[model samples]
Target: MGAITIQELTKSYGETNVLKGIDLAIDDGEFLILVGPSGCGKSTLMNCIAGLEDITSGELFIGDDNVTSVNPKDRDIAMVFQSYALYPTMTVERNIRFGLEMRKYPKDEIESTVKDVAKLLQIEHLLDRKPSQLSGGQRQRVAMGRALARSPRVFLFDEPLSNLDAKLRVEMRTEIKKLHKRLGTTIVYVTHDQVEAMTLADRIAVMKDGIVQQFGTPYEIYNDPANRFVADFMGSPAMNFVECIVFEGNLIVESGNQRHEVVIPNTQAVIDSGLETVILGLRPEMITEPKPHAESGYITQMQLGVQVTEPTGPDTLAFGEWNGQEIQARLSPEVGAQAEIDGEVQIQVDTGKAVLFHPQTGARI
Candidate 1:
């Protein structure tokens, strides 16, 4: 019953359009993450869902109710923002029960709800403490508790972990995932952190310039991107887009004056494609140190003078040049790509997962 349906939703402010033709359906108990840069209208879309902003056009339905024009208080939703907006003067107990009290719930019922939520969040020990006395993480829990007391149909979180330190952010992210599993409420979370979107979402909607670029599971978006921008934006080190010529059914990438032929899964697509040139998308993990006894079937090598090598404990990152553009290779420490190493490392590029895009349109080939 908590499902939300948005159809051709558009929001504009005078001459500027913030959300352009957004169409999305959030299923009950599904964890959905909306991610993009600062001005991509993710937050604006969240506000529209919560009934805080008036929609300029289109339809919105929560469950079976047409709540597009409903007031914020009437919509069955609870929101937690990036800023933990708890009352400074109220104790944790009061803050948790305030929403229930506003809705005229009985005193005994409110107390029971507070006890249950406090146990769920494991903040029972901190109930006597005021906002000023608690740590940032504790305050955030209290804010979430305040929302949970409402037991609404849908939950909205607008970058709730962006304010915490790195370690606390990781901890809270796990907590939120656990909370969602326990509650099984529909959630629409907005974040600029790609890591968060990948780890916590059942599905991710990547946005750009007020448009949703792609909507799919994290694995699909990462491995099988729809276009160049999605491939470039979703990865940590970022997928390297190397310009190369498509000649004779083989894509070419050159390093140190030697041209390397990269194998494509759809070789016929490249052969039939009228494009003489295209950009090859390769992740750092795909390009690695050549295996000592590695068979040479589908893998190819690129010879490059090593520029710099960095050890990040688990793996070594080697930076080098390909066709005058800087590219990174994730190398095994066993491959002797240590820091200050001077020799050229023969890095193997796996073409199984490699993707090709048109140079001009940035569309997948």
Candidate 2:
């Protein structure tokens, strides 16, 4: 059975429509991530789901119960906010147990729950410490512990790890993933972090301007984005888009004084569409230093004037210009260093791996 169902969910703030007819169903134990830029209605949608904000239209369900009209407290959900809202006067244990205590859970049961959650979060030793004494990561964990101790029907996390430093954020991300594995609870996590969405979600909902642009598994979202907006949003360094003109069912690109045309094999639909101008999307990794042993296929080679190079430990990012637009290629540090000083580089383009988009609509063609 689905753990949560949102049907035609809509929310507006006076003149602004925050969410527009959003529909989603999350299965039991699934981790669904809502991701987008700021003011994209991710948080508003979350607030609606938590019953903190009344919907402008539509219905929501948790388990079998309709929760659109249900009170936040009565909905059987736990939320971990970005700001660790730990009680100033309460010790970590008390903060974690306060919810249970408020519900009049037996003292012994509350103590056991706190102990279990503390042990799981590896904060057993810090239970006696106040929130002021704990690190940011520790306080965030306590906030999480407070929610985990409840064993609610659903977990809502609104950028819970955003406040932590990069290292601690990664650690907490792994911890949350493990915690979800053990508890198997339905989770609705919201974040602007693409890495977090890619690493943690069972499926990702990419939103833009108050609408979901794409909703699919991480692999699908990454490899097959619905539109240029989604494609540009998900990847680090972003996908490089190069404008090209179609000539005799082949993509023709001109850079500087050179012009190269390559046939786009197997994508007949795009070729048959009678589109003249198209944008080619290629990931940095797909354009790399040409290897001597690389097999000959439909690969296209382009000569570029190296503009800049950034060495990011594992790989070096080489930047250049193609058809008057900036292009990036990922290459080995050794090769990148050599090209960096030379001011020129030979880049091999895997044309088969390239994606085509309509320049006007930004939709995959």
Give candidate 1's error at residue 353 in angstroms.
Answer: 0.8
Candidate 2 runs further than 4 Å off: 132-135
lDDT of 1 at 47: 92
lDDT (Cα, tens digit) per residue for candidate 2, span 1-365: 33999999989889988898898888989999999998898878888988989999999998888988998999888998766689989999899999999988899999899998898777999989999999888898899899988978889998887767888788878988998999899999998888999999999999998888999999998888899999899989899999998877788898779998865654576677789889888889888988777675768888878999999989899999899889899989998999899998988988776778899999988
The digit string of per-residue lDDT tens for model 1 on 57-168 reads 9999999999989999999899987677899899999999988988999999999999988986678999999999998878887887898788789999998777667886
Please list the C-alpha lDDT of all candidates, in the order they appear. Answer: 0.86, 0.88
Q: Each candidate: RMSD to true structure?
A: 2.2, 1.8
Clash number for every model?
Answer: 0, 0
